[model samples]
Target: MKHSNGAQLFLRNDPAKTAPLSTKKPLTIGKASTNLLCMPQTDGVADHHAVVRWSVGHGWLICDWGSQEGTFLEGQRIRNCRPISDGDEIQLGKVGPVLVFRLAPASSQPTPEPAVKSSAGGNLEFAGQLIPMNQIKFVQLLSRPRYPASFSWWALLSLGALVVLPWPPAFWTLELVVLAGWIVLGSRKEHVLLVTLLDGMAYRHSFANKVTALGHRNGIRKAIGQPSSA
Candidate 1:
């Protein structure tokens, strides 16, 4: 079966209960009648449990709406808004319901480029090079952490020391502040866009802003006649 544009969610236990995500608005899940994915009879679900929406800079994200039982993304109870990737599982509550996220499928056939000259349309600007959209064979996004796990682990160990060391109140406060900084810094990632040409050559462009990288990748996909996973 084929899915509509944008992303989609299917029930974990029942894939047939698939719902496509909206690009124009948020998809609300709850027992309330106004919710797009309303489950009036579902247990453990609140009136406004959670919402899935698209952010221009962050792509697709799922945020808990202060539900009685918080939402879980792959078993981890999400604190705030968390970016959703393809194949991620979202649980409504501790035991309410489960939904799977999926990206739109690519076209089965290669898109035929128009007869106009490549220069007819403006080329995609990338790292100071002009690339014809038709020359792109594939596009992929890569994300890598800016810091190693050990940095965060050391911060955790320092925080753990306070429990047995009987540190002063000021010292405790300083440790807490440092740990917070470590967490925020550790979570930073570098996003890169990889574009492969039909001739087998490939090029990558890195972006400090995830939204800009996603936009570039999606634009290339659309220009090449493939479905945008945005």
Candidate 2:
């Protein structure tokens, strides 16, 4: 470690091994690193895949990937997530080891805290309706997903596959089933859109008429000031 004026810098063979130093001046590391690894959002995650995946931020990435050996942090072997630290050795699953971490320049200022996002789950509320947690799954199954883009491609691919298939058992049932699924997926998108538009119009008209009627009733009731029903 060396100091110039009021700033200090640390040089290390491995940036991941450097520890955070407290300081009064803002410290800027040439490169910062952390052991916590986050993988890409995709690549599959199911109840049964064995290996789990998690995402951090920046360039940090971690994956059990399919390794049975697993990753570790502190002293605990993490089966659900990769290890992360201000500075530490990364024992990357079974594929040997890779040292990774954020390298912060030596500092005189108090070590700044990393930004963290809220991981808390929130509730969904509908006007005049309070849905209990247990009923959420039932409602979700009844609802449709947004922006499903596979239907059109499925339709195209199914058609192409049908053309290439020979006659009999293979093409006979499978082709029709594929076509049905493809069609169902398409119609679902259209159905959802139509329902949304119809509901929007109905809601608009219903609210407008309701407000107008309520206004008239209020006017009459105010004139009387005795008792009125709307």
Candidate 3:
């Protein structure tokens, strides 16, 4: 069955569990009675944690409700509000539940081509890479960098090591030098295209990255046909 141009939220740990969002009303996700979507009783989730709403102007929007643990998109903590697209991962709290967002099939969508050709053995071409359709467990299109370009674990550890230095000027100078080094070594930001294999390993591709979530969804549909049975 085909759906509309909405979104699907899938539980990362449990792929069978899902929340389909294609409505006008905001979907409330939390661990309490008032929420429309009740998450499992777990640490880090507040009584009323976060909300996913749809607007004609913005498409989909995710907002945090000032929880103690906080909500995260990809890996960055959400501050006020952020626009969400297909294939984006939303992590609740620091070690809380993880949800993957996907674009729903539109009602007017065309019939998908066969996922595999009997003679060719199901090969798919994506982002200049040849993928075996049967081996792909999932596909995600990322518009932003998952990790902060300027932040690194080595930089943080170096800063911690400098705590033993004298406070007046030695510590300050080292801090500035470390910060400059981090900036100089920062990596370039590019669009990320991820393909997860059945063995749980993932392949990544980076490029010009101008495609929208919906555009990626359509492309995947054409490449792999309809969604596979879970």
Candidate 4:
């Protein structure tokens, strides 16, 4: 759905655009489609690997990874990511059994509860409220929050080594060229650290409440630790 402010959307699907989520969890994908994009994992279980990036900050989060048979969604085992929709059952690998996911659009409002004459199941012992799907626990595998302990500190050390030292003395242009390539790939972490460093600097220079300011910047309540704006 189009908004003047350009709320978060599934870059892939333009049909039913969404708004900021009720909660900042990854499952609360704003304006994104259920077409899951499973990125390639060299690891045996491609769809289940960490750093899966098909979610555009909003959408069904399938943690289908690592089992002899593999996880199945809606009776279909995903060889690669597939579009998910309401009533889709997600089978987590081994730990828990079958859990279904039901997606409800944001714009639809709850109708008023219908007046009841007599409870149909009044004599039957009631269990609890039926939560249709198991809660999806979201790990922002691709985008780690920029803070100390957010990423493997190994990332920082590698960048430091690359920046201060040149290639070995006996190394030829081939080695130098390879080193440059290494630096290029390793630079993603460096760029993130740079943002963290910038935040650090800002924290040092001012008296503004760090948590509140950062939370606002992240477009979430300060305590929730959500990563970005919608």
Candidate 5:
């Protein structure tokens, strides 16, 4: 695919073999072609089954190349060409091999600065909260902890309190409080990082950091087509 941004195709069933679809040429997928980028070993796959192409304006596209069984995307059979987005599943031939697609940010586009905007004296709007940037002790991106919504420390403390408390009513109340907290603050999307800001008052805010510091560093390298620093 001729994508300005890099694209990746991963085998959904067998995630070991991942193909980088960052080249300008269209990636050919088939059963027995030396020129093919992905050659699945499943039955019903033709020699030239399908082609995944990309362009700057149109984005990524998957086109069926007159295969016998046909190409299916997310269970529906594609007529000829279909536009695909990140996390879209592409099945070459009917029930042959499922592949997941992911498109990175285009290297041509400029990286935006952190979404901090000045409002008052040394204060800025960060994650919908107006707080003094200077008061921020640190900022970091945290992946969703295994527990539902509460922070790890909060969970541990609450659990310990429940264990030590002798009153049965108090234990149940604490459990209900934890459950309510999870219900109120739990995120719906998986794999999204939470941007946390710790301030002088020991208060923390968990907000979405679309462009994290680490992301900024890596994005700068990707935008310039430079090798990432170790």
Candidate 6:
């Protein structure tokens, strides 16, 4: 969707109170002053809650940063970064303040071409594989949390070294660093684009980045003349 003033988030109850979103950086939604969509007085809002940002192939996406109460998109708790559309309702918590996503008026909407390419005749080329468009049943985005096996081995080795190392205070800093790295790695995830065929066989392509994955999904939908479903 094309909007003259980008996108805006208005309070569900009080539409007058609105927060304009920026395409440059991820908009932070929280009770802190640093957040672009600050809800200081709102109940259940955390300091560093959720974030909304424009992605490359995914358009707009909202993600919860391990918030206490959690963030909900259209009544579903947002586990991973979820793509959002116009008129979508986002609640900070189960009973927290609600914000409605809006795309401001514009003269013309963007018409993006499908990423699909003609490999052989009318067959579609996706993820380096060629398949007929007629065989496509549906396309969906899937996510799974994954921590690198190497990281676990390195973490265990580090902890073991810390146990036997001298100079307790000096090595304590390194231990803390390792712990932080482990936490970050544990939260890492892998995104996949699963294209199911009419024959019940599915083709899965993994993407390290969600934006690229969403782009492929959007392209497939356009190629098949199907509506976008996030």
> 1 or 2: which has the higher TM-score?
1
- Can you write out model 1's per-residue Cα lDDT over 88-201, one digit (the tens) per residue? 999988988899998765552123333222342545656434577778788999988877684857667676766656858766776777778777878899898998888998
lDDT digits (tens) for residues 1-230 of candidate 4: 23323212232223343332221233311112331322232223333331121233234345433445465666666654555565555544433244334344555422322221123221110011111111111111122222434234445545555666566553344445555655555443311101122123211112124454343234211122334532
lDDT of 6 by residue, 160-222 (tens): 867777778867877777778777877788999999888998889899999988888887777
Clash count of each predicted structure: 0, 18, 0, 3, 0, 0
Question: Candidate 2's residue-wise lDDT over 1-230, tens digit each?
Answer: 22333222122344333323223222221111222222223122221222211122221223343444545443345554453444544443343333334434356323432222122222222221222222222110112433376566776776776788776677768767876776666554211101011123211112224344344334323333323352
Return the lDDT, model 6, position 139.
95
Candidate 2 TM-score, C-alpha based: 0.25
Q: In angstroms, how far off is 160's CA in candidate 4?
A: 21
| TM-score leader | 6
Worst 10 residues of 5 by lDDT: 188-197
Model 6 stretches with alpha carbons more than 4 Å out: 1-4, 106-230
Residue-level lDDT of model 5, residues 1-230, one tens digit each, is 22224477888876667776743577888877554564656776788888887643356788898888899988889987888888899887766878888777676423333344233234433332445654544443445644563556467867797779879898878877876777556654223422233533433334345345456434333333335453
TM per candidate: 0.47, 0.25, 0.44, 0.26, 0.42, 0.48
The lDDT-based order of candidates, best leading, equals 6, 1, 3, 5, 2, 4
lDDT per residue for candidate 3 within 1-230, as digits (tens), equals 12324466888888677786744477788899778778657777888899887643346778898888899998999986788977899988998999888777676323344433333257654543456777777777666644464677557756685777857587777777877766655544457667787899777767554455445545554555545221
Per-residue lDDT, model 3, residue 119, is 33
Model 4 compared with the native: what TM-score? 0.26
Give Cα-based local distance difference scores for all models.
Answer: 0.77, 0.34, 0.69, 0.34, 0.62, 0.78
**Where does the lowest 10-residue lDDT sum fall in candidate 3?**
108-117
Output the lDDT of residue 41, model 2.
32
Q: lDDT winner among the candidates? A: 6
